[model samples]
Target: MHMVIYALVEASTKDEALAAGKTVFDRLVGTDAHSCAVFDYYVTFEEEDTSVAGKARWGDLPTAVPVDSDDGEELLDRGWEATKEEFERNLERVREALDEFSNEEIMRDEDLARHAFHQVGAYDGPMVFLYTEHASGIRHRGQLDRILEESENPWIVPADVHF
Candidate 1:
């Protein structure tokens, strides 16, 4: 998800860039206030290197969607629904924005001039951070742990199960 977002916004315009950032924030808030609550927003830079060679290429920034939970069951259904929508909508929007940028006459720094007229596989800029998505639903895993610690339910911890 991080790689895709960065790649999609590799050489985007000002207005489009702001829109992309806002979309990420909206998704995070809607998903789990706990996780999105930790992040600031999608980080990006207007003036950057669009080169395609070197170890510091733009696609290497942090992309984890940070999340925390005090009560998992409280947001189970709502969190799942929002998470799904975030992934789908953002993916499509990013692709569309990149495609639109590809048509413009983009100019880059001297080091990146060689590839200015072409669409390389990934970003060669200074920064390219993408949004994060929750892997395990917000509180489910922790709920499992809490059940293990607070309950004597045999099914929660199988008799034959060993870690």
Candidate 2:
């Protein structure tokens, strides 16, 4: 899948931001707009530093470190095999945190977790990279951070997932 990101570029006006964003977007997706959603609007998205990306680059996604030369789906699957219990526990926590939401929302989130397991195929791993298609998961960043912190090999939420 194509990447989804909200970037900050130096600009003096809205038009400038859109122009810069489009330029970056075009370069990222190779001018092939059909790959991912593209939008331009006024928004203030909170960004945090990624461990894999390092503290200096706050908004960018983390890069993947190939595991024994394996990358993509294989890496993710292997990680899952290695840490299935921890991953499941993390999901249980998500469900608990999301209890205020409707059953549909919770199920959707569970599905998102599963999809992340399947498709979070690349990352800088000492721990498996946990990711989701839903940017809204950013709200629970602290939970992810805590989970990672407590782990022997932490699961990182990648800033980006290659391939």
Best by TM-score: 1
lDDT of 1 by residue, 64-84 (tens): 211122222222333334434
Q: Which stretches of candidate 2 lie over 4 Å from their true place?
A: 1-3, 32-163
lDDT of 2 by residue, 10-128 (tens): 34444454455444434333354443422221111123433432233334322332222243234344334434444456556555545555667656765465344432332212123
Q: How accurate locally, in lDDT, is each candidate? A: 0.30, 0.35
**TM-score, per-candidate, Cα-based:** 0.23, 0.22
TM-score of 1: 0.23
- Looking at model 2, residue 23 earns an lDDT score of 46
- RMSD value for candidate 1: 20.2
How far off is model 2, as Cα RMSD?
Answer: 15.2
Write down the RMSD of all candidates, one decimal each: 20.2, 15.2
Error of 2 at 129 (Å): 14
